[model samples]
Target: MKTIQYIAAVLCSLVLSGCSDFSDSINTDPTRPGVASGTQLIANAALYLPGLSSSPKGEFMAQYLAETQYVGTSLYPQESTSFYSWYEEPLMNLQAAIDSDDLDAGEGPIANQIAVARILKAYFFWNVTDRWGDIPYTEALQGSDNFTPVYDSQESIYNSLFEELKAAVATVVEGDIDNDIIYGGDMSKWQKLGNTVRLLMALRLSEVAPARGKEEFNDALNDGVFSSNEDNLVFRHLPEANNQNYWYGQIVNQNREWWALTETLVDEMKPVNDPRLPVYGNPARESDEYVGLEFGEEENIGTEEYSLLGSDIYAQDAPVYLVTYAQVRFAMAEAAERGWIGGDAATYYNQAVEASVEQWTGSTEEVADFLTQPGIAFEPGNAMKMIGTQRWVHLYMFGYEAWAEWRRTGYPDNLVEPNGVPVPGRLSYPDNEVFNNADNYEEAVQRQFGGDDDIHGKVWWDQ
Candidate 1:
């Protein structure tokens, strides 16, 4: 943490002074100009990756972690979540970098920097489109020139993303870049990350458009992807107040025990003797065993009685895994079962489980024993269920991604809260969109949901 912070500080100082001596750049600047240097723009854009992965709303939606106190989100409250901040900040910064010629050659090759920006931009857009279905894509981040940008279909957005990711991977040069908080400007890892994201996105179309899914999946597989846990794309938080883990702030700094593991997670893991259970959360205070509270339990809700997040998870400097080898392996396993790729589904399944266990537990000592359990064992007929369930568990605090997968696969078909509200298929468009971009918003809602804009409306891929 100290080394990373020191490097960042030095890089920021150098960039602010208009020097090309350092290899990295600043953490984040909300007031940063759209015309900033390529390095500065990329650095600022990268800052939001951690927050994206560890979103509390996503956690609640996935029912992995529940609110111990307020409990509103756990009950599946209907709300208009905004993507404006995403576009206004990171997405814009990434766009600036992608368009800029102000390259800091000292940081990395200009090609690599642009590639990184493009990849991050695609990822940010991916998150937005997944959450809200159709979104302002083609005209987004155009600044004041396009406040009322038309919403692009989710299908189009995904197609554009695949192209962007492919181009980004191909654009990489043989040079390590700095100012990259993720991967430390490791170009090979960046290439793999891009391909991995493409692979997963391709797989999302398995049900809706399997031909495209198979072609893209194999294209990504052939290009290259994460082969080991060391290649995981992670955002390492600092111990400083400005960059501490979000969970740490909620649980430790604020002295508020607001989030706890849900019964949905605890029941699945505990009964199967899942090795990741201990690493996922702590044992309940009252039970002295791992106990997850019922999702959306408004009455008799005590923070200590239910398992809170594991200590390491909420630690100030904990690293959030953005994309991982385990995720790619699971995608491979699923593709195999779908016959989109030629390989034994069980091989990839076992490897995915082993990779996930090694990733969370930091050892494979118990993986063999854990895999022998009935629920954990890989049976070809039951492959999809096993793969989907394990993928959900492996996703952990990556709530939105898990929620998206759940919607796609209908896996763990028991995501209902105590109030009888099942997980929402999608978040409604932001209120700002309804008011400010009413015409386009209405058109999108009408096109996608037959004029409803409701939470239960399916995204393009989910359909």
Candidate 2:
């Protein structure tokens, strides 16, 4: 079991050996093995899934956490961050697995392997397009044939991803796969993942394309979604040094006490006596209470004055949650409120809150009491606002997804950074694009933002 968990980490190092930077060329690591097994590629791709939720950049954008020392990220100073590592590493491996002709039924069904690869590829592309707006999709992964691939619009990418996810789900066959670190070859869980991702992706189109959003959401829900917390997509970190949680590397290994709960989050949860507060953070040293630092404050505040993350959160073997049942229920609640589904919004809302509480605290002991509170209870008048706010809370460490939700719904409308710069709608393109792929990059920027490739520009779906 331990060796199984370490397979992805091993493959990552082997595949990426001696590769300094992968941005210049389409083919990375020319010295590495060219024809890796489908299973090996799949394992390599799975390794990157944990970083999606654990990213500090995402946490800062979402305002769930703040910097205790160096506060550059909290102030949102990054104009361009690279997507090259994503494409070069996980995305490339997934694409290789999908395109591989190796038929080893002993490892797993070829159909199933391809299906999983396609699903993962679609997910990686979804993340990229959401962050960068326009990215190389159609012309990507062409190796030496195309060094400069044209950027696809976010709208086109989303449309293609919808089709890809549906196709991948339909392609699944009966078989357990080897080197499957995530679900241990549980095909049913993979099916649920496919549907749940499709459902969430569909909901993202609610504001911009309501009719299509309703159709896709209903389709995914009808097919199937996560039935319970058991079906959540989580990446469990290994205790090994190479596979340790990202937080462990920062706080435990390096002795860096740089992160704390943000005032925006602590105030909201503490005031409501949110049960997850204790599980989310430790009490401040001076106050002996859960205290959050004002986000982006330039003052050299004492680290002991604010709450640090819970011990379990930074543990080496901690599990990173990619998606959860609570998120699905919240989506259902919103769909119900939008008249897109045949269910009571309050019932789903209540279920969502209960699930979130259970998921965080590992028990439902406080759920009944928590729900009855005047402010916590569902109010029909403020249905959408309530759903959005509660959903934001449910998405504690899953920062990028939460940030994307905030952009789409504009709920928790009180997120004010004291620095006076409004939260960005999307990340700017990386410098590699600006210099290497200048023509295509400039074209994308001009088409999307009227020649300005800044973080403030909104994507197609942020209408």
Candidate 2 local lDDT, 1-463, one digit each (tens): 7465465557555655223234566665666555566777777878889877888889888888888788876787757888888888888878777766664778889989888888888888888888878899999987677989999988888889889988988988888888888888888888889889989999999989999999999999988999899998888887878788999999999998888998888988998899999988889988889999887876867678899887888899988988899999999999999999998999999999999998888999989999988779999999999999999988989889999999999988888765788888888888888889999999999999999988888989998
Clashes of each: 1, 0
Tens digits of per-residue lDDT for model 1, 155-242: 9999999999999999888898766777766899989989999999998998899999999999999999999999998887777776
* Candidate 2 lowest-lDDT run of ten: 15-24
lDDT by candidate, in order shown: 0.84, 0.86
How far off is residue 348 in model 2, in Å?
Answer: 0.6
